[model samples]
Target: MSRDWTSTLVRARSAQDGGDLALAARLLADAGGDPTAPDDALRLLSGVLRAQGRHAEALPLLETLTRRRPTSAVAEHNLAAALGDCGRAGDSEQAAERALTKGGAAPETWLVLGRARTSQGKLAQAEDAFRQALAQRPDFLPAYRDLAQLLWMQDGDLTRMTQAVAPLAALAGVREDAALLYATILRDTAGDGAALQSLAAWVERGSVEAALAAAAAASGLDPRLALQHAQRAQAQAPHDQRARLAVLTALIAAGRAELATAGLEDHLRRDPGDQHARALLLTAWRLVDDPRALTTEDYARLVRTYRLAEDDAADRGAWLARTAAALRRLHPFRSHPFQQSIQHGAQSMIDPRAAGDPDIDRLFEALRAPIDAYIADVRPGGLAPTAGGWSMSGAWSVKLKAGGLHTDHVHPRAWVSSAAYIETPPTVEAGGHEGWLRFGAARIGAAFALPAQHWVRPEPGTLVLFPSYLWHGTEPFSGSGERLTVAFDLQPA
Candidate 1:
């Protein structure tokens, strides 16, 4: 089938420019043209795939592009980035080195190299690469952020991260983010006092971000002061989620959940897809015994568990043992990452496509039936969204040490969420429901706390699925060994 390669490329570019990426990808993929000569089409197709979070699908196209333009530094850099995105850190590192060799030490190349090094658990090497990037481009904001995050993850050394990024924070374009980061870091690491002191000047001068930070730091310490700060932030950014959420949290903490219910309901009425707001509203209504909370939550009907490998000839215990061993090798960090509920455990990189894990692929395939059933169950249940289908948002494995447990939290940005247990501690069965998954407990204290309505015993080769808005966490258990699991989220497409 003879085809015009140039004309196809032009049409593909038009679709891509007009935001019809699926059309662009289809045109490029189906075009019966010379794949090697039309390297531009390959590049464009790869970009389209990656933009849709199909990193694995893009890799071959990028590899072909690099092969076609052997000496092109940009091609090598793109391949390096794609490799990293696909969770092939070692190959990404090699490609980044090739990019640096050909491009003469471009800062972006150095930044990618640093990320690859970090992924490989080479913290010292990663730091050196990040320093090299900063040395080359003094005003690169990403370099500062990555280096600071690396420092924080490596050691909880707040001073080191602050000192490292201070100069770059002074740059005109970087100050706003740096200020916000500084506030959050202070509140997380030090306490409310440090955050309040640091944000005082900015808050007084009408910085909505600073006021929100002030609200967060003071929430539990001084409820009235926190509410005031949140109100100030809300006044500035009337429609911002951060401000709205801050004000709501403060209002609830001050024993004014009834007052916050109207606002939360209004937000949900306007955007029912806001799982975070929905979760908060549930908490507020439950606190005041609004009756709607229990009906809306519907834990009995909505939350379900499945025992995996039931149909397979292999024993479930053996399957779980095999899967657990394979998953442990993917986890690289010794400590949990920031902004996650994982307290003292190591978690695998998000959405890892560990090229050859057949057990993983099989397990995921088995999950499709249950997920499809749930989608069908929800569609006719009065909230039939305009969005038709659901797709996986992210996937990660968690290996919780003896004392580790995820604090109660909701997947605010997702529609559905899940966890599949590969390993469980003996403590789970010995006594109590330790190491068990509990649902419906709001992550708060005193009168504001909503006790868990349901609990699921952790079993090897089993999974639990529920709405992402449900407040959930695991009970911490101590003894020996680790509790290993894979978790993922889903969103409407």
Candidate 2:
């Protein structure tokens, strides 16, 4: 352990350069325990630990490095980032501020500060930090992406989202997700043809991310063009599942689902819990009236509603009021967030399960019985639902204002999906059908464009559960105070 630290660090760096993180970690661990170990060894070891998601193991080393190099901006910045990763957002903010105070004006340092602020729910400060970072380094694509994401979530203004990152659409090395976001915003504002054309310049330059973006934009515009870009992207990055998904989407769009059917089915066979693949395969089969697809669309068998049971001793009214208040505080945004169906509303990004509210915590406790009953009792299709196990995958609360509605869509990645009402506006309480949930329609233009076959009215403290493939939406209400609800998706555990 007390061997020459310098030589060990050199070998570790070489290992790290050769992409042998395990070897580098081993070499550094041998010396990292010694107080006489060089700063280089501890730093490299911390990096390896972080890369491997061993954040707890890395934190102590990072703390030690920060203490030893108190005046070093890079040391402070690294600790800030590591602290953010370890969920100490307040500590991260302090460390990042210290780094900046130490004359570290690097764009990376600003980005770290932005991320720390974001972790603490300081969206405005995070947005400012990202803007400052971008101003310092205009070619910093990460800044563009972070800023765009923050603005989009804040206002849901597609125009602002475009203005935030469109300047960098011509730059190299933008995040793949950022490219897709830009394309999606364009598609929303200017239509699929314009969206596809927007990325053509970059796609023509052999950028895989751009090609993938163009593929998404061209999904409904030109099937052949979408397939071409997606195939090109897949060829460049054979292991990227996103590219493969693009190819599959294009195949379905091109009416050549036959070519993609075997692989999708084989993948589902190997991993039967892959509901996303199942959804795609179902879509493909529905194109040709495959019996397998028809069975899954049995709305009556798959969709059901549950009324939360309340005992005489339970203070149901007060509990719902508290839960609604908790949810209301979370919806600070001006409009709905990205890639969601909620329109003319604001949705909560915080996961209610971990929001640390007593009433919200009890909401899950209330749902457990109904969810269990639904899973065990409901017979989906002609048989039963298939899954290895079941658990909630993600959850969010939506607060829809007047004229708010949800467009028809399916949850491809979920085996089960749900919406639980916390509060309903006066319109719904009046026995009116406005703002009612409608099911059994694929709004996506296709051969099987079915009108909504069933409708469910929302009531306070009631939950509706349905198969993920069931297309559902909400009708816009005329005069409404607000409609508040929480929804979650379930997948095989």
Candidate 3:
């Protein structure tokens, strides 16, 4: 039996080396006679599943392996990686620390630790972990990627960003992910011209990955070029979903929203139940000036039913004031890059449930009725049909000072989105609509030519709910007082 298991493990390794992961997993799972076979099978099979992005499937096996071999640094590292991939960032970080304590020195383990820290909004710690990984293995590609992404997320000075990425960017073909990150930083900070020059040079070799990266970089800077590169990516990998999404995104960004309708319609025809595509289609309708996208009746429905009721509270004004104060106290006010609208300001990480403020918690509870009403009334027909209950996948508070504004963008992951004005800036210019929410404009630098279709004046104690795909941003305001608001996303259960 021992001989058979040893041979089976050897065969499994051979299969994995030959890129037959399915065969490797099957062989490992079936080799169960010997006592050590289970451990070997669990270890190998977890790796196989994780490589395939089946992290949920890999998690239980890794957990069991970790329990069986608590002292094995490799097992603990693998478990931490699985946990990170499955979105258990806090747990994954703890497990990764245990892996390090158990003497794990693999660059991949450090990369996992870095990613787990990133998810938990620990940017400095994440950067250190990634740097540590790179220090151990200079040629490690994953470490380069993790480090570059972490650095890009920080609103650090231009010199700091350039210094960190200069060494890695100097070696382009060696690490494609790092090169892409470098291009993104340049595109966002310097100008479209500089980023396009670098991206264009990189994609001249006609690689699909390079083309995809170029498409992303050119997305807002040069929509035509973005479309061309996205089309190239689609041509190279016709069935790739990312390529398809890029094409759709480029079409909208290029000010050719009318042309995007057909592509979205065709995609929906093939995959009727794709919620993301459906949401994009809804936004496309609005972009092309279609009335069916968001009619007067829809706006009326939102106005009538969506905003949270003030009558539910004992004292509406006092409740809102206290809620705002409590939320402000809960967080240490960090500069999280996740909020695209905030600049020279602070934004809270997404997690209203764990915010530890009774007033804020009460406000979220008060928002349920309007959320339920929007699903029943305003949501488009082809979108995800909700059956009453919904989850707040993300929630955050934003404090924007003078000249601070959220850039125009859409929430791709949300089904329904909202902003509740917890505190408002005094004297919103009625003519200019400063500090008000405007919809239907693309991000800056897109040159998308279309003007905003709708604007909602901010009022304290009122919540405005809109489709997640709608491009929205705040009009820049000049004032001494801050504009504090709580935003949340609602996804169907």
What tens digits encode model 2's per-residue C-alpha lDDT throughout 1-493? Answer: 4588778888889998999999999888855568888787888899998996677689889889989988988999988888776656678889999999999999988998897776557898999999899888987867876777678767666777777776676553344554555666656545678767767667877778888878766665667878899999999899877788778767876778777777678767876665556667866777666787645346667788898748553578788888999888766676655467776777775667756789898898898887777787774322344654467767888888778989777776677889999998878766767878887555542222455667889988899998786778997887847788999987555
TM-score of each: 0.83, 0.72, 0.74
Q: Is candidate 2 or 3 superior in lDDT?
A: 2
What lDDT would candidate 3 get against the real structure?
0.72
* Model 2 vs. true fold: TM: 0.72
The numbered model that scores best in lDDT is 1
- Model 2 whole-model lDDT (C-alpha atoms): 0.76
List pairs with backbone clashes in candidate 1: none
Q: In order, what lDDT does every prediction score? A: 0.79, 0.76, 0.72
Candidate 3, residue 182: Cα displacement in angstroms equals 2.4
How close is each model in CA RMSD to the real structure?
A: 4.1, 5.9, 6.0
List the candidates ranked by TM-score, beginning with the highest: 1, 3, 2
lDDT of 1 at 272: 81
- Candidate 3 residues 283-368, lDDT tens each? 67877768678665655554332445457566877888888787676344334352255655666643555555688878888887
TM-score of 3: 0.74
